[model samples]
Target: MLYLVLAVAIAGEIAATVSLKLSEGFTKLWPSVVVVAGYAIAFTMLSKALKMGMPIGVAYAIWSAVGVAAVAIIGWRFLGENLNPTMIVGLVLVVAGVVTLELGRMH
Candidate 1:
């Protein structure tokens, strides 16, 4: 259940981030609204996950890792953004770090 809430939080964060880009400096109305709503949902869900007994470190690591990877993919595949090899390597490093953190928590 904690993981589930964290997943929802991650989705919200991702949507909010994408909407932020589409908001065009807040010049667009609908996207701006989505940005606000998404962030609100994201933070609310994240706090709930924490309250549900997920360690702050572990939860945050997973959230940031997934969010970073997902947003990068969305930008590349849907937003015509460039995704270079260097960026891919950086993402791999981020995932690796998160994996290490999660695995260490079992000890």
Candidate 2:
């Protein structure tokens, strides 16, 4: 299903992004390889979802926004990055916008 493919793409993208951060500017070998492979899988799944009747704009918006939010949380929790209230608010707004776009497409 398109939804399943999209979910996988999102998960792959999040994993890829996290691995990229752990790659330490790509100086590390294993994490760097993971980053590359994860991105490849993510994009492949995204392409499949597109072929399955999902709108390109909608899918891309959701994918990118969700990826950003997930990465921010990962950074905050695992990377010791600071996330103040403003940052959380901004992420919430991004998620809300994505939800609105998705809902609009159903009409």
Candidate 3:
């Protein structure tokens, strides 16, 4: 349940970030509103997940790692950004690091 909440937080954060990019430095009104609202929901859910007993380190690590990867993909797919081989390698490394952090916590 906590993990699900964390996932919602991550999705909200990703949506917020994508909307931010679409906002054109807040010049666009709707995306700007989405940016603010999405972040609000994200932080609220994330805090709930934390209060529900997800460890801070693990939760943050997973959150950041997944967020980065998801945003990168969004940039590539929707924003005309490059999705090159090097970026793929870097995203893989981020996932690996998150896995390592989680595995380390099990000990």
Candidate 4:
């Protein structure tokens, strides 16, 4: 359940980040609204996950890793952003780190 909440939180954070880019320095009204609302929802859900007994370090590590990876994909696909080989390698490293963290927690 906590992981589920964290997943939602990650989604919210990703959406908020993407919307932030779309907002164009807050020049657009709708994207700006989305940015604010998305962040609010993301934080609220993240708090709920923490309250549900998830270890802070583990939860944060997973959230940030997944959010960053998803954002990178989104940016590459839709935002005209460059996703070079180095960036891909970096994202792979992030996923590997998350896996390592989760495995460590199992012990």
Could you say which candidate leads in TM-score? 4
Predicted candidate 2 versus true structure: per-residue lDDT over 32-56, tens digit per residue: 9989989998999999999998999
lDDT of each: 0.95, 0.95, 0.94, 0.94
What TM value does model 3 have?
0.96
Return the TM-score for each candidate structure: 0.96, 0.97, 0.96, 0.97
RMSD of each: 0.8, 0.7, 0.8, 0.7
lDDT score, candidate 2: 0.95
lDDT of 1 by residue, 20-85 (tens): 999999999999998999999999999999998889999999998999999999999999999999
lDDT of 3 at 66: 99
Residues 19-104, model 3: lDDT tens digits: 99999999999999999998998999999999999899899889889999999998998899999999999999999999999999
Per-residue C-alpha lDDT of model 4 across residues 1-93, encoded as one tens digit per residue: 778899999999999999999999999999999999999999999999999988888999999999999999999999889999999999999
Stretches > 4 Å off in candidate 1: none
**Is candidate 1 or 3 superior in TM-score?**
1
Ten residues in sequence with the least summed lDDT for candidate 3? 54-63
Enumerate residue pairs that collide in model 2: none
